[model samples]
Target: MASESAANPPLAGKHILLGITGSIAAYKAAVLCRLLKTAGADVRVVMTPLAKQFITPLTMATLSKNPILVEFFDPENGAWNSHVSLGEWADCYLIAPATANTLAKMAGGIADNLLLTTYLSARCPVAVAPAMDLDMYAHEATQQNLRTLARRGVHIVEPGDGELASGLTGKGRMAEPDRIAAFVGDLLREKKKSLQGKRLIVTAGATIEAIDPVRFISNHSTGKMGYAIAGELAGRGAEVTLVTGRTSLPTPAGVERVDVLSAAEMYDAAVRAFDGADGAVMCAAVADYTPESVSETKIKKCDGDMCITLRRTRDIAAELGAHKGSRLLAGFALETHDEEAHAEAKLAKKNFDFIVLNSLRDAGAGFRGDTNKVTFIDRAGREELPLMPKREVAARIADKIEKILK
Candidate 1:
């Protein structure tokens, strides 16, 4: 069960794909299905056959108003149920009580069932709440699988610690249905209220500096923070234009999204939106330089090696800073040495009103986690925020933007 406070419910008019796998907590999927329906989302459930051993199909079918898909083809007429079509149909894909076996399959590319196939084929953001015995979850294999899935762009809803079905418990309990629903609603609804009437632009992910047709240099950003910020802003009320590099992240609600591959493409998108935008958050880790000349085709790997010359890409931040007076411009700096000095220098040079400085050395602050410990530095001074989830960090950024445009 979630704590005392209930999140605001605003998940109306959204299509949610609920994937149910085999686990003891499968029964809770029914209640979760109900909660989702009550909150205004269109729910559809796809279950692994083993999942039916715990929860009846009729129960989920009644709540979702859609036939539960379990097999690739119907046994009667062999009518096909395409996973790709299902993936594209939903705004978000949710899997509650995800089992250890399923997680392993997901991590290793074992598409033996309809659920796994759909998950593999999903284009929407996938959120999984894993459920298993304490020992099964504590095993190294499980942890590794979770990390692999996370790195592969799957959102793992961390399981709660408590009593388990085995009568021995430390963790691995599935979160309560109401709380799970609220969490999903919060995840989806977070930005709806904040960005409703405003207009903003978010540049996210790592920009590629192509060395040749087949190779490029980039960072390990994965674009999580930037994408999260964009989704949050759109959820709140703002018209968000998310200009993202190559990432598997889905388009957030009520946002006009543009996809790009390189710094040049991202630069083009950012400048065009800044033309009439109220503000912008340059959150991408843009490559500092690009290969001076890209080989038309893959460079042959022959002889000792090769030296590829590089040239600086146009400064997108500088362009916006020059014209961004009444407009609010926010920049993100992932620094290593002389953190504050570098951020402040860039703050002045890039003409950013504020720069979010995160030191890579700091634990849980830099990249690849749901949390961050950051120091927001602007012209006034610096305010160090406690380590918190990236969602909260995004909220603080939104709060600052509200103050600016208000």
Candidate 2:
């Protein structure tokens, strides 16, 4: 029996149902099963009939220490393998090497095989790591199927970009076994209802102010930080409204996204969302100014330099702060100089419960990066955090939010 303790990993004592499909990536399933077992999980594998051709069941069964199931009934004994029982027995059902075929079947609720049948009956959280050729993975149908599964609360362990079996170099490779295992572990670890019953507004990305049909002004904010924060909040069971500017990032799981282009549009959406929200995280790098008059057509180069007047755009955080009555609010300040002082000032000025500060001078702690180093400033004091991934930073911010709400 697995023991539960801080020393024990999150997957300890967890029941993991591993699903394998027909793909060249099926060979990786053996390593994945071993990794899950090493993490203290009791793993049982279910495979599609076609998958056995790529990787043998004997290999997986040895690693998992459990019999591999591929059919509904035992041929010799005539005893049925209950899909419903398998689904309910597991804590999480993870389908690695999820081929385009399997994804399509899952999206359409077509359960011709034991794996698909078990997937349909799974009461626990489901995750998939897709593997296919670049073109097939990029197909509209496959993308739609992935989107459908995502919308239905299925976790997607996004495939990596690399050489494909088709001699093409691009995305569609299944994530490595270690990464997949770690993702499952993290999912289980953070799957708590800390922020349950709370509604939150998270503003993200850089708002684009149009100067003309073709010309516009925008910042380098990729909306990553805001998206991370939104994901963290949603993961913690908060009802999140992500008011975002133009960004290529997909909407985070369990978040309701409101797309806006200009600062005015963001202001409108943020204000509307904040009306009923328990709090708001002002993470967007909203444009401070916009062209006074947007030209009807693109302005052509003239002999001399032409000037465009600029007007102050709405201050979303300040406006929301004015109306924040006993509500929790958080703000972010990315500064080049006097970061702590500036953050403290904003904390008071915006009526924020706390303000997160990061300096551009700090390497790997700014826009467009996956990591950040931050300082949390509040009336009580300041807590400086070491450089960490944006997701971890978001979790820390959520932790502070939880304390404030309490």
Best by TM-score: 2
Score residue 158 of candidate 1 by CA lDDT. Answer: 68
Model 1 vs. true fold: TM: 0.65
Identify the runs in model 1 with alpha carbons over 4 angstroms from their true place.
1-21, 24-49, 52-95, 98-182, 185-194
lDDT of 1 by residue, 261-307 (tens): 89999999999998889899999989889888988888887989678
| Candidate 2: segments with Cα more than 4 A from true spot | 1-9, 22-27, 71-82, 99-105, 108-113, 131-145, 158-178, 189-192, 296-306, 336-338, 360-363
lDDT score of residue 75 within candidate 2: 100
Task: Write the residue-wise lDDT of candidate 2 on 102-207 in tens digits.
Answer: 9999999998999999999999999999999999988889988887898788898878788989899988999999989988988887567999999999999999
The Cα RMSD of model 1 versus the native structure comes to 8.8
